[model samples]
Target chain A: MSQNRWAQQTLWGWGRYPRVESLVARPERRKEVLDALADRQGDPVLAFGLGRCYGDAALLREGRVVLTRRLDRMLAFDPETGWLRCEAGVSLEEILHTFVPRGFFPPVVPGTQFVTVGGAIACDIHGKNHHVDGSFADHIRRVELLVADGRVVTCGPDEEPELFWATVGGMGLTGLILSCELQLARIDNPYIEMESIRVENLEQFFEVSAESGHFTHTVSWLDCVTTGKATGRGIFMRGRHAPAGTTGGLSLLSRLGRAAPALINFPVDGPDWMLNQATIKAFNEVYFRKHPKGQVNSIVHYEPFFFPLDAVRNWNRMYGNRGFLQYQFVVPPDPSHKAIRLVLEEITRSGLGSFLAVIKEFGERQHGGISFPAPGPMIALDFGIAGQPLFDLLDRLDRIVLDAGGRIYLGKDSRVPRHVFEQMFPELPKWKAVRDAWDPGHVFQSELGRRLGLSGGQR
Target chain B: MSVLILGATSRIAHELAHRYAENGQSVFVAARDADEAARVAADVGVRTEGTCASGRFDATDFAGHAAFLDSVRETVGPIEVAILAFGDMGDQHASEGDFEAARHVIDVNYTAAVSICELLAASMTERAAGSIVGIASVAGDRGRQSNYIYGSAKGAFALYLQGLRNRLFKSGVHVMTVKLGFVDTRMTYGLKTGIPIAAPDAVSRAIFDAQRGRSDVFYYPHFWRGIMSVVKAIPEAAFKRLSL
Candidate 1:
């Protein structure tokens, strides 16, 4: 059967920055996806699982983007083992909606539930429990990858291990992921026994996080505007799954109550100056004082704990029309405090505080050669795209990250020099080799791959 | 129950097929575009636990209607409901000048539909139970100067469906005629009809409800019924004088 023709569209990542026009085809069937890959006669095509990457990793400027959303389907599930096999386009939220009541959940989920299984694997996203469960790739048992030669190969840790690992964090540049088998975790209930601790500075954050090792999940929200005596004053939170037979489980009413009432979206992008340091500092002061000084424990629904920002529909629009840049980088466990403090000091001195600053500890690294996480502390800061000064500050931060033996997450990066990217991920050469072995023609290329010089010399 | 959706590649028909498949009903999609039919079948198959199949069906091929129905029955079991949803609203201006164009429009919207309905009616009569749905258009109620050719074809289809319903009423087989208005579909892609277009999914939902209720003849979006009534009530002298 002849594949459907492509429609030209102007596409952007979740950040809504750096828009690119591309030829896109939405193939509804597995055969059409295969046929599209086989009969590639245009610029290299990248399988866009969902537009949730927050960066250019899923974009293909003036190229083809094969949309995989229509290919979503749950092929099989094993209730006993909590094992699930589904097409790549299936979102994490879909899985949760289907299996949460059945006492099962995806082992690792990112901040946003809008991510697809394929996007999760490509980014190798991590959750708050990264200090325990590692990244999304750790729970993936196998993947059916459609490579450049029109062949569907089953890849796992043992079978085609190199291809599997390369494709795990390969950012859709290795090939199109057809479907995958994931091992889900069994949750006793849909509630979390959470503890929130108010910390004064970065030092207290480490102490509280160290004491939270036994907890299933741990993360912190830092107030970036504070400096001097209170350099990273914020709230630290830890949580564990509530046991079954708990008083308040995740019933429909409780779930609805936990969800924000009538989600309010920022209808339009306000003036660029609306999110200046003055406004953010004021908001941070109120936010910081809102939490009590001592530890507060509560049994809360997992929705608010896992995805607080998701409550608001278009929260990203708060960053204004230019959109925002999320700068997320991880520094090695050794000298992590000094490195993080230095990064924070730079932000404070610049007087451009991010409204949303998050910090989490990563566990041991996985076998995915290009995976982002390591045994370190990862910080993510969102800065509205003001102008060149913001880019300049980020470039300076990149040097600090590189010197501290750290790397930035490609899934959240829209602008990083190719040389810096190479220095960050040392396994790129090996990943590129594996990618070339499978796709010698480099039929699966993306804008991010080209920007990072990972498009198999096509640039 | 299994549904046989002829011209399943049409936007409205495809949406209806998905609705049926999602409800765990087996669906067989028949369309002239082989790739589209197969894609829709696979998509619907994954959505439902029930079975789905696709086959080549050219609506204009009058000789192939009987064979196609037989093949569908052999492959997908008896059709509990059959939707005749294929039609072409040819270029009215071109049709006025060309006999072939006018004939093509009539054959697709009327003659071909009549052929398929006859075959389905006979099969359903033998089974003693089934529903046959004909998707005619609201333009059939009263013709205007702009699109009389297409409207006339739909008008003829609507009359044929009325007779079919009367003939099959005693056989326990329900025949439904749907008069759709201003549907947003690929067929009306570039034409600015100056009316609020209805979504195919919404129209499909209405069709499903009407079929379940065994409605004989209903206008999709319901409000179209009142509008077409007013249109049909206009005197021919005044209707022909005003450009619609």
Candidate 2:
């Protein structure tokens, strides 16, 4: 059947990138996706698992895009070992529903469970638990890849090491991913033992976040508007799963069940114009007020603990017709103070306000150099592309990132200049070497790849 | 296209710059004060230079009207499309109470625009391909007791634009008079009225649309078309009694 571009406008986790192209093919099976990829005529092929990559990383411009949503199905689960195997299209939401009842949960999640297994592997996505559990790559046991030659290869840390590493954070450039076997973490209950704290300024925020390093998960929202005394005033939320007896009457299984339907498997778009600055300010006030200063919340379920923002539908439209570009990058951990401060100052001076601004500390060693995650302090933001100043503002930001020994996240960028990107990610040659081996014809491509001048050169 | 905008400090003028810039067109924003115009240009991301600063354009300086037109033409170069977003919504009470105040509105709205249009229309007729847009108002449809002094000036400008449209139509140049309703701008901030307010973006979109399509006249909101029709049809005595 022909694909429906209108229906597949957005993937689960990544934001939307409009396609003026004709059809969007939804494949129910891995073979169908592979066949579609194999049969395409010279057009670029992009495998979209769950469109969760923040920007246009998964977007296939004027090309044949394979939608992996219908390929979702659970294949195996080992209750004792917390080992589970599922189709590439299977969502974290689905895994949470099936395993949380049996006392198992994903080791890491990027704020939301609405992303596909294939997507998580493709971007090597990290979550609040990234410092402790690494990324989705750490938990992934093995994955089956359907190469450009239509050959299905099973790869992991021990087998086909190059392809395994390449596919870990390859942005699905290597080939079409079929299924993945991920090792889950053991949890006593579905509820999380959460703690919330209020930070006064940029200095306090860094100290508080570093202090929370002892915890399993930590993240903070910094208000870039205020300067000098009041800069970075916001909330810091940290949490770990609750243990057996400590989480009573919380009905962990019931909470997971209710959350499963509303959250776990698939996420729909939020209502239009639902995230304006006024509304966001109101929400921030309420959120800050509700959580008392330096208070530990006793019981928090899967929904509130993970997917709080997904309660509404079609949230992206709130950015208006101009859409939005999510910008995220990590500054070197050594010069953390200077690097992070410069980033905030750049944003503030640009006079651009972001509805979603997040700052987190990282310990994960640099992956393939070009890969986004590194041992540094990472800051992420989303900006609307409506006005004239935004383009120039982003251009100014690119220079700051380069000067600070930082690199933009490929998975969440739509505007990084081609020259700047090449300079920042020097490990492209290595990734390109692996990409050449798996798909010698260089059939796989994405809008982001072309935009960054990656797909144009030799495989 | 080389476009020169008068009163380029207004929000609608800024939006005009955006529209032209996005389409890869060159624009020059001109204001009464060079510094103010330059600032507006910087904010709107357009090329700005001053030709009419120093309040030398006393529109009532009817003696220097011809010289003012010649100066603008000489400084800005041969403009392809001339947009007049000039004119003040003067204090209605002041205009009603003092004859000098009433004349101030007239000189700016009608006299200056007419003198400029005469010079511009002749140039456009010679070029035989330019467009001139004069922004009038719906208040000109029928004089309201609250703002008759200002409305009468707009009414005169509206008629002048119509005559220019008719004459220029033969010369292959288009003339447009936009009858704007209440716009949510700095100009209308203090007016305690419940009129449907259109954003400057919306107004700019209308102006560009009419310019591209070369329509002779436009009502900014378009709904004001049907509204003013009923308004004009109303009898004057009854209309005056109905506080609108």
Candidate 3:
């Protein structure tokens, strides 16, 4: 175990921000996982899976990062119960590919299916259906956690409540999540009964969203580029799984026979100056006009409806090497929707419009100490980094969010200040208590954990 | 239809087994590690809900190869498809110093593979059916000083596959030799290279398609053919001088 060689490499979050130099180990089996952990000595080690975290949650600076991607294997599953026990490194994309056509689907999937089950658990990712079915971790039955003491602890909601909740959104600081038992949802078919509604202004966007609460999945693409009367106009889309024996759009005989268009990729990172405010505004205008004023109903494959961005592989490369920030923050529901309006107004005043803006409502909040979703509307926008000016804009937006009693989603933020993070997650100490109990020496730590003061004993 | 995957615990073989099982074929997983093979079998079984079984079979054990194949035949009936996906890339540096180490690498990659393939070929010739695909390596296309021993062994196996394909052609048995590129598996886990590494599942898909189409030889990534062609075309003097 001590003889295992750890290679030095550079790693960054999905946003490509704050690239960290670390000693990396990619283990293909459980024994090798132990080898990597045993050879860690006193340095912190974090299990990195697929690295879908938009921030630094999966990175460890100058520490060992055990790459879990190679450890992917389906261990066990019960067809009748629909309980799948798989290694933590298995990506949701693989699961969907293998299971969806077979009539089973993950209960919840984030915007992109590239994320690993462990990453989904670490961040407690919420999806469009989050307003109804809750976050991804809600479907997890149990987890096999490799704690700092070289012991595998099986924890669940009922088995070890404290450890379970703490590790749920603990940001890999608790320990390395080795494997998990996830409950796969039984679906009628692979098709979705979808509707696209063109929204006009922020007030109407809220109204339409509240009205469409009955739908299983709902999300809106807000055009932040627009100002004046069309301040927050965008397209509001909602969908539910297509019911049995009913073809909403596809002919009954030709079900699932639709040919998929060739996948387009960025190939390489585009120039940083490509996505200026003018170009974004123009694209947004054309996108908005394409959808009709009223609702348009159709039956669509789950692929396009759930993971549109996934179709374009290496879509993140479009942001270039300098990197970009996906500033995502959630504001608790205010009937007036003041926080959202204020944030949009600030962006408009600053003469900046994000490249991509998404708005989704989070339903019931599950009580995890650092879980981001909490029965509110969370808006995420991609902002090209312009150094201090971009940081200043985000800082101002943070204050507005704080005043509105909202918090930024740490999972998507690469540059949120420590003070702001502490304020946002006041229950950090409670989570730390459980973490300290399991990892007393802070063996399981990452760049995100270090930067946010998530653990004790800084030295 | 029944499919037998040797070295079932390997990512590529596991996926090939999965592909066959999901298509409603009886799948038998065989590997050096019995417990690991059974575990892989059970995982595929759940996904496909097909007849799946596992047994212990080591590729290096020349004497025990017949008995292992018999056990699989007894359990899963006639194997319509058989994939040889096992190979050991022993430390090239050590192999250079030790003849025993070099022999072991050759034995596992070439000798063991032939030992199994010949037995399967004999039975398939009698039945006048089956597709046998051996996952060889692009490393075999041209030997480099860094890994010449392993490359030469794989080079031998690919040639063996080509000759076997010709012999089996008269018996209506399709034979495929896959010259795999840098795949994301245990073999290429941490080795640094600029070439794009192919995923195990993607490689499995290509092999599966190749067998079904009765293609004799094809590169997993397809582009590897072009790369390997250039390598083979290089003058031996120049190739040795430029040590890759």
Candidate 4:
């Protein structure tokens, strides 16, 4: 039976590239979600969270996109155990707003809190605390997946382990995650005691990063545009959850009332030149110089420490109507952090400086399906779209990463060549095998999936 | 205080249930679909620091109103806030062709609404403390050929709410009528409107705030009040010729 539930609309990833006009259904309840999936009209169906994935990993051209945002609902929460059972559409912001006052937070959150809980698992997202806390999938106790045959299978570490691991970084290809049981981490207070240390050059960055490993969270903001005497200068910031009785902090109750901080919007799309090389370099210079020459200690709210950019609503518009591409890649730990240094040198030499460059270290590697974080140093940069030249630059960087035994984050990739992806992720066959077993029909698909040959029919 | 939301399947009503639940009030979500109601109740229950419950509630079942309400009061406490959010915009064209269709629209939007509300009014008047919010529509301001059937039903409901407010005034029971413009909901699913549609959550917040201020009636997206006033002032001769 045909249903008029699908509305024809245009969808784009957070990068705002490769926009697709697709038939989309925003389901407000579980039954509506099933109904939307069942009446696909012979088109492939993929469930979409908040469309926060920077690339086309969540987009599909002319296909059925089931929007899960409206399905948000918290089924249950055990405050004593820090266990939260919620529908997949619940955003991390909502979770933080509701739980932070109770002295609990998600085990790991990416740079933004706008992403849905399901999106975090789909990407196996990590935060500055990856050195200690790992990624989102590690804290998941169980997930209720709507598989190809339309059965809701309860999978986890013990039960359906293969399916559980596969779904962790499965990019929504394994199945539609309807809801899950997440293990939230307890906090003494809803604040972070942060310290920023100025580091000059790539050598200092790795040294400071290593020394700060014992800290709960650590990351660096790099001046990737600088060359010669000042190359790779940055400020390494580390923080831990503020201990109880920390002076000059609001009581937990007031902080909870102000959990959602007010935001100022980026009113209009900036001109292309707004983020051009010269402007970025100038901004980087001032940013790098603003921090004190020595270490400085401060106390901050979790919102600013973890999700700094989220403070400015629609900040992505600063990259203009075409938007910017966020390129993030990881290289395995090597002698003297050689791989990362070489990559940064190439980035600076290109003269197409990234607007925001951040570096973080991942702890001991964890085994799993296509999860991005491992034992390595990861760097993320945002560059304005400059057409073929930009793609060429990425292609050059791809070879360097491939040679260094590293890989580009699929979540941040919108234009990686198929061959490069194949070489970067040799474990694709294993992930595909699990997909075939669960979704032999290849009913679930995405634009990124088809672009990089991550589907059953492609090869 | 505990709140009861009838016809809670609608997005606005769900948001209303959510707001009350978050405020630490016991919420009862009742709808025509038992499973759907139970699911929403489970969802809303997590937000409340108190308690939440749900039961099957078909507004058209006038015969069962009292028993259903009594069971609800038993599950939750006395209903301090009652909102009637159920209505049918039965296709105007189809409604005109069949009396059953027309009656269905009128029965749910007008008759059934008054039935349960009177039951609520009776108890609220006795308790001498409560608030009732009736979700009417701005379409009720002036009837047009396109949707006069649904419009007229809503018009009667709004008029009924005004009278109810007067009767309950001496008893200190507050009554509020909300004339909503186009809300981002399933009801206005695919329609294109000149003005940006008000979000369901925003509309819910406005109604909640209005009820707190003891507003007898107000238009959602407040600008709708101005637009409706002009439409209401249009002469019947010219209004009849224009399709709305």
Could you tell me the lDDT of residue A353 within candidate 4? 82
Kindly provide the TM-score obtained by chain B of candidate 1 when compared with the true chain B: 0.96
**DockQ, 0 to 1 scale, candidate 3:** 0.39
Clash-forming residue pairs, model 3:
none
- Please name the candidate that would achieve the greatest TM-score relative to the true structure: 4
**Per-residue C-alpha lDDT of model 1 across residues A211-310, encoded as one tens digit per residue:** 8999989999999899998998899999998898765544443355447544455567767888899999999999999999979998887778787766
Q: Name the lDDT value of residue B66 in candidate 3.
A: 90
- Which clashing pairs does model 1 show? none
Write down the RMSD of all candidates, one decimal each. Answer: 5.0, 25.1, 3.8, 2.9
Residue-level lDDT for A25 in candidate 4: 84
The candidates, ranked best first by lDDT, are: 4, 3, 1, 2
lDDT of 4 by residue, B11-90 (tens): 89988988888878889999998777776787777655556788899988999999999999998989999999988888
**Residue-wise C-alpha lDDT for candidate 3, range A19-66, written one tens digit per residue:** 889998887667678777888867889988887788788888878999
What global local distance difference test value does model 3 have? 0.85
Report iRMS (Å) of candidate 3.
2.2
Model 2: how far is A165 from its true place, Å? 1.0
Q: Candidate 1 vs candidate 4: which has greater DockQ?
A: 4
| Per-candidate local distance difference test | 0.85, 0.73, 0.85, 0.86
TM-scores for every predicted model: 0.82, 0.60, 0.88, 0.94
Identify the candidate with maximal DockQ.
4
